[model samples]
Target chain A: MKRRTVGRSDGRKVIVAAVLVSLLSFGPTVRRSDGQDTSAIDRGVRIGIIYRPGVRPGLVMLPRTGQGLDSVRVIVARDLDYGDRFEVITLPGGDSIRLASTTGPRRSSAGGSTATKGATAGALNYPLYQALGADFALDITAAGDTTVATLHDIAAASVRRSVRVQLPRSSDPDFRQAVHRLADQALQAAIGTPGIAATRILFVKDGKVYRIDQDGADQKLVSSTDRQAMSPAWGADGRRFAYMEFQAGKGWLYLQEMGSGKRTAVATTGSALDFTPAFSPDGQTMAFSRATEEGTDLYTINIKNNCCLRRLTVGRFSDNLSPTFSPDGQRIAFVSTRPGLPQIYVMAADGTDQQLFAPFDYGVTGASNAPEWSPDGQSVAFHRDVAGTLQVFVLDVRTRTVRQLTSVGRNEDPTWAPDSRHLAFVSDRSGYRQLWIIDLDTGRIRPLLQQSGARLPAWSPRLSEATSSTP
Target chain B: MKSVSLLLALGLGAAVFAAASCGGNPAPQNTTPAVDTAAENQRVRDSIAAAEAERARQAQAEAERIAAQRRADSLAALARAGEEVRSTLAAMIHFDLDKSNIRPEDAATLDQKVAILQANPELRIRIGGHCDERGSDEYNLALGNRRAQSGKQYLVSHGIDASRIETQSWGEEKPLVDGHDESAWSQNRRDEFEIISGGDNIRRP
Candidate 1:
């Protein structure tokens, strides 16, 4: 990872502090050098050169040659498209675009051109791709645990990059996960950002934690017991989750391991109501809300042994809770009722310099809560009370401009996908509360589950192949 | 019989008086012959008419005063009822969307709860905080807890014991209304009170 220079402006420093705190804060805040006016910086952040919605790059997927590679093609195509950075063109009538015919098994160490000769020459057909309005083409070849992905820049008539990875074995239960890793690599090769298809979304439904794939497949009930659960949070390691459970007439925070289904109940004051647990980006510290007679405030606990308990917010009269760390773990955006209503507030990780975020109308826009920092550290998405219904809104931390995302029904609890362009939220637009995903750039909203009664979705970071191998 | 002097003047004078009086009272149900009888009859009729008009004016003023007093009384009674409603245990105070602070409009309602608790020393009450079905469940619980605390704080400040009031948060788990519309959500985001001990034992006579 490359580090950018921090400009002298206060807002710029704040953005840098936010990004330095976490590069996965959502997306990178607009970098403004010294001597530029605040208005210019605002404009630059909103209309930045990278990740513009309208000028999406066009890419095409070619047919793969191997057994047990059907799932890989489907996963990669959908994952790349879901990133909202590419226009993936498939052959007419939904047929796979065949690259070349191959003879028997052939493998080589350098460049691996012996088996891909015909495929390589045919993939450079720029006129065909130009006629189809594709700017790049992808050809994937899989054999056993190894897969090679070649990306061709059609307009440039040259191969852009090739990514080869030893995926999980076809017989392994996590084969789809390995495929997701390859998809992410291919995306990184084509565009600078990796795809989030390999990530999982953790949500609460029926008082339990449920896990689902990024493409809205493989819905699994991860929490085994029937305890009332809330605030499902994913760890940075991608194999652990923490949630608040109501048991024995008290609120308890439980940390669950994905592989073994083992859970450890983190002890807090027996009389205090502890909930809303969020793991830091480094997975070493856990921040949560602890309710006592004084008031509900944010607190952090060491995750290794759960020994170091630290109070983050001092709310003698106000209610401060729901702490989400910036990707760098330097700043936290939480909900505070200090101004007479629950509104989003950003403060340093130690809880100093708490300031109201994105000045919103107290009565008109309602109170903003459940704020999740974007991975790039540019924006924060939260649900505000608009009239009586809750609607999702994204605020550009740099510009202080807000964009409302949902208007119908009641949409809330927005969690950003790893790509930062997409958000998974819980909505009741379909009559019952259910999980829904929206690509902010395209205004495309789809239900993550056909069934209802889902809330509080927490998206996982991009799942590395090493983590997936634990299963 | 009557004797006339200066006949031309007498005829004009009599006709002028009768016309000016516009059918003046016909001698007030009495017959008497006097030199200035027509003038006397006109003067008596004018006095009686003036007395009647004054009486009607006084009657109208009295009615208006009575109506004004009634309006003021009615308004005072309504105000008292509103205050009573605010302090009642049945009244549920609503908060702003994500707010736990008692809204100014709801302060009177919580004050009503405080008053009820003050009046009934043996009364133990529970305040349950709730949220609309919009936010994350645990945060809602935390929000709900704050809301309940806000109400409890108001009660304590008003001289109620903290132990007399227990707080719980249902969050969005329980809703007063089922619909997803604003009408339902606004109703759901509220602090409701339940009498835990006292009201059951006391019998109102």
Candidate 2:
């Protein structure tokens, strides 16, 4: 069946309902409370000390000579901070630093302290670094028309033997891909794991579902029909998914088996409206939004036994929608308008302990819905309509810091891949709605799919060992 | 009983008319011979044949009237069924853009739906949720599921058993309207209801 576009007025009503439900539960004074500590702490690597006392890991950013230095610097700092790998420091000149002078730890200033001259070619200042607890330093060089990145092992007092490659020119249309590749390589060198730069994202576009590589290649449509199919949620194993389909004037939930291309309906209640399905970390249960005349609420249903169903929320004053499960499956993130505007909210998996996650600012009175959790359970990605433009944003759960992702066009329905290194979202930058992917480390965006119109993408979890063996 | 009396009255009227047609003058009681008696017998046989032909004509008219009435009833039923389908479509819940959540105002319609399901025990229905022309294909597929689930939940809450309902989300794959504007979008975001069993013979209206 062919899918149809929803009318704007009706869409607005839905937006209003979703926002109202999210705000109602938060109550008035949706602002961040004084007791709320919005701090970015408790962040560190989990690796054991594998390095000799002198060996250290650091991140470097190099800009092409012709590029804007300030822009490059700012972007590099943001990317590094986002990667959560290093604390950034500023150097005075391109060639004046002596490596020896900064061997020891030094206090980092609020805005970033300028490096002193003659700090290059350093000898071991072990006590100084040990005192500052500085593990590594990043050095960036833009020479001639090319940029070169060098990783310096502060502890070992040795540079990485492999020479870093220059990213493709900024003028190149595929510069985004080049940047992503660079970031991926840097991450791999530092962390010993492949980055999300090469992963692909799947999302709905123009009433059709599509998939594209992380670098925005190999776009293809998964389904072509006239009915509205939305909210793609991946199972724990990543091989299968549960999505909604409306065909022949009926609504149903279909379990799509990726490899076999076969779909089966899980349940069909012909009366109420059901959507926004999220799979548990174990893939045994699914949570979704159930809407009726009284108001929209959240519900959970077990996949194994069709009879095991539970309603998570109940009320007439607020309409709750877009229920997303936390990575640990203990909590859920959703959008409610209970407080009179749409804001992100969190609740227990059984629908208790409800609280608002996003601070309601008067400057941005638009709706914030479609909350998706990062694979590591550290952050959540959601879409908020600011001044009538929908933009994607991420919130660090522990830090309570919000970061905006998209600036141009209307972007909404953001989902994270299992690695938590990238995000797949819907954008209308190409004159029509299409699916796009963003590399978290590089902050570069690429079109994931060429769908003329699409929205709502759910990234599947990595395949489980048991499932892979059975297959 | 009234119809039978009316039929009897018509028969008496026909007999009276036949008597009036006979001449008032009476023939001598014993006069005339065997030739006269034979002539009288021929006249009586002719009158009986004419009466039988008149009754056959009346019966044919009555049969035609009854057949016409049956045809009119059938046509009326068909019209009613068509109206029912239109009304049902109008009463269906309209979904949001890429969302399957049912709006609060649609509750009254759902209640009527519960009544429908309760009245038809053997009837089964399929709920279909749809989305507007936005977002990815896969996401819409999921959104469609949400819409269908929303409808199904309402029925279950209203005391209709879940076993009788089936759901399918067509996503953006199926749409009732084709334009890209708000007008088309509103028409596209909707949850459709289909009766799948038992009530096929019932008039739609």
Candidate 3:
């Protein structure tokens, strides 16, 4: 009779947790965000990083222990929230909930929260937390030059996973990025996909190229304020970038290193008006648009040796500009004006097999431009004019089926994050041009930058080179 | 009327001198006091006529000086020949949406430039194409290039040396007007000319 009563109470606890989660969650709402209706990519997305409706997992950060570890706790919590896979509970100050502190040596298995009782909520009063709607909690203990993070499942009342991440002293230059990488790994451990916290987005603000982290911190200007700079892009390694700068009545492309600030102007063509630089996946070649009296055409040069400048298109009198290379480096997608209005067209990297990539009616659609191939090679994101306003659109590479992703405001320049599930674009939704990020699966929209006058968002590739190894 | 009066006064003085001459030179017959008095009166009338003619001549000179000053003032309001030629060269030629071909009206504008270039062989100029903010940055760059190149082609075809003209495209980066509607856009989609060298004294077209 006693065993039956215990079982009944356990079932009631699970039911109460589910009900509370539903009441507090903000589900996916409607947004053109700008794309077309009736897309297969939105329906039967087998491999999409989709989130279940009305079923958000609750996450909490166990109050940090040890000095100089506050940033680790705060950043990880913000990152996981931005990841859009959790309901990140913000605990009030001064120990609103019971948290066990660990000042001693790190535990061999999982620290604190003994879980010796097996199959309960937390080590102390976890059943109470479960009743309060927490699904998981992260306990972080700072050790010498390393931080130990223990993941605890509240309802199961057991340890889930533990990871020891390297975090140099706060004075270290890369200390913040190291913390960002740790958050990415935590999301990878909590969910199946890694977070984009470690990635940096390059954008144009007040005619200068600026770089910002995913959490909206450390906004640094990468280009000179006096010089005219636009269309900044990076290769897969994220070590260097290519952008267009004006000099002596012509636009010149420059390759700049992120580490030592070394810059060199491209040597392919010195006479024509050149702009819109894109790097190949291997970082060996750069494809750009050059214009002359004959016409505007696509051109590629071997940046590794800075020789072998090759022409990609020859539509004389018709403009062919804005080249975006495919993830495999075999093909490039660009904007061409051959069919009345500008349209997106794809061609082989060797300037062969050129064809229209994005489909639109002759007189129906306005214009399609700024096509960017995703890092995963599954889709190409660009903006198209719908009626009179420009909206963001995505094309599935395999099916060639296009879907509109935004319609709320004038959204343009859809650049994909390294994770491929989020896009950083410029939108005037708040009455001014600003950078906003959208997660494809969760349908969550958040402003990436606070200031207006920001455009040409270029997301960096995954920044885990120096801090690799997933949790 | 004033000229008629001066002519009448001269005529009267001439008659008086003739009477004096006739009376004095034709006869040593009469040495009458009344005849001498008449000669004195004639001399006095001649002197008055001379002073009046001098005043009239001075008035005419003052009128001419005022007219010349007015003409000079009007000329100052007009730009110098070199400045006018520069304005015609600097006159921006506009293009249709996504088009670079020279229109008939814009061709007329270019013809003015060609004439200026031909008139001043030592002159060299650069044409910069621009676009509205409707298209993407990359697309606008190409469109701007085409507009500028087409203008250069027009000048070359009109017998202006290609070497004397340089072309560049500012794309939509630089705008003559800061607006978003058609008024701003129409003004933005244009080609501007700047003197590169040897424009110290441009000959008017």
Candidate 4:
């Protein structure tokens, strides 16, 4: 794989190198180098660059086994660039300077042939990478048994970052999420700000509800009732949540304070099956599925009043199930089985100007459900059960690109964390249903909650300033 | 000789009259003795007949009052039992959307019904499960049957002894209220209990 560089200037390469050495003389306190203002670098510095004319300065992402790269890498690379700290590069095979004799096939053969192969290989690659003008090499190795990712800083001549994440030996489902997190962390450590690693996901699984950390840790069950409980959405402040629970044979929407375990039902329209609840961006209103004998529809309820509900969709033939409000809260995207099969549809908040976002294809046997908008509102993630196997897929609104996120086992109900850099989903791959988080940048997968079968994860919005101010 | 015979007969008659006068008042001495004996015997017989007629009238009135109280108590008990049966049945059947299938948890409520049936052997009940206003009328009818059957089957399974229970389905046609929202739907989808026979004799507090 070819690695790219950021902030490379051919005219100042020599000057920057001299200045860097002098700056190092002052120790870590120097904090920045010349040509890159210390103030600007102190605030935030874009790493991964080597001085090379006519070459882009970014991290190059290479498919480890030459298989088709998962779209999660694209999302990761795009997110890093969007963070304004790194440039991303795509190094196709046969592009750029050839270093096969020094760092490629030779290194593999020499390691098997000699005891001194390690030192020899490391020695031979210093000048070769310098000639390529790459500040760091992001080596992503995903083979049959293991996936190892490392960020090597050629300028510092040290292993700046390395992470080895492994999936269960039995199933080799895509690990887009792990790779994304690894990349994001590498950038964070290389620069200064913390990435979206410590965040958690809240979603529903097997009709129960769960919340899991970003690294797929500390998965805890939030709700497990006899009747179906689903469509958990986080409040904008991230400390509270809203979901749908069928209690006393009535579909009711509930808002819960996460810490105190106190819950209040927002709507109780008796036998109707209310589901697919999504909180508005302001945390004041909730959009959810309200199904009666007449037909299912989408409705929004005010959080404070709880009793006042406004119907958002009305039609003769269409039955809407999943309702998700956009980041702006002006529009809602949901799944409607109106066209005889489940399809993605979008409508105004007040049930006006309904338009079909994605058409249903009869060829696909499984239905589409759980339409969740990305944090940025640029794309939507959902699950489609194809031939009894549920897989996660994302639909880019602008490009109309459908990217498959998972390949093995039955994986469904994809939800994005507050940062939109990772997706949490439910998978039955572990012999029991569990919650799993996928790093969109690196394709790494981690099980968030394993025991007692967790499912249906929804990510809470970032904490608000007022809430965080409280003790 | 004729004078001696008359004196003896007169002496005997006078002695008999003296004996009767000493025991009580002289038996109606002068007027026809045979007539007096017949009248005394007739008076004793009439007194006995009058006492028997008075006893018969008292017994008939007492029996009539007891019968009236029993009828009123039985009617009130039946009303109370009917109300309990209706409430218990309402709590028993829970139906899905456009689908009438009794869930297993409903069995707890059905178990209560077995005890009621056992205590009131004369009480025969009709179970009816109805659906909400969702699907076609015919479909809801079938769904309602499934719901009622679910409740009936549960009661029989818990040893209610099926013969006392009867099942019926009233589809979306008989909605408790007319509305499309969740509240109305919940009211419409229900299992109702109706007393068919023998409930009138149920005892109440």
Query: Which candidate leads in TM-score?
Result: 3
**Stretches of candidate 2 above 4 Å error?**
A1-193, A205-210, A218-229, A247-274, A291-295, A301-308, A362-364, A418-421, A440-442, A460-471, B1-175, B185-205
Quote model 4's TM-score: 0.48
Model 1 segments more than 4 A misplaced: A1-54, A63-66, A93-124, A144-146, A156-171, A429-432, A441-444, B1-127, B134-139, B150-166, B176-205
| Model 4 ranges off by over 4 Å | A1-194, A204-208, A220-228, A267-271, A304-308, A363-365, A462-471, B1-205
Interface RMSD of predicted model 2? 6.5
Q: If both were scored by lDDT, which would come out higher, candidate 1 or candidate 3?
A: 3
**Using lDDT as the measure, what is the rank order of every candidate, best first?**
3, 1, 2, 4
Docking quality class, candidate 4: incorrect
A333-447 per-residue lDDT for model 4 (tens digits): 8887666656678888778988877545676645666788998888889887676556888888777666777876678778887667677777766676666666565344556
The per-model DockQ list reads 0.27, 0.05, 0.53, 0.02
Which candidate wins on lDDT? 3
Show where candidate 3 strays beyond 4 Å. Answer: A1-57, A63-66, A92-135, A154-156, A166-173, A465-471, B1-79
Which ten-residue region of model 2 chain B has the weakest summed lDDT?
B133-142
What CAPRI-style quality would you assign to candidate 3?
medium
- A314-345 per-residue lDDT for model 3 (tens digits): 98857899999999999999998889888999
Candidate 1 per-residue lDDT, tens place, A182-217, comes to 888888888777778788888887787888888777
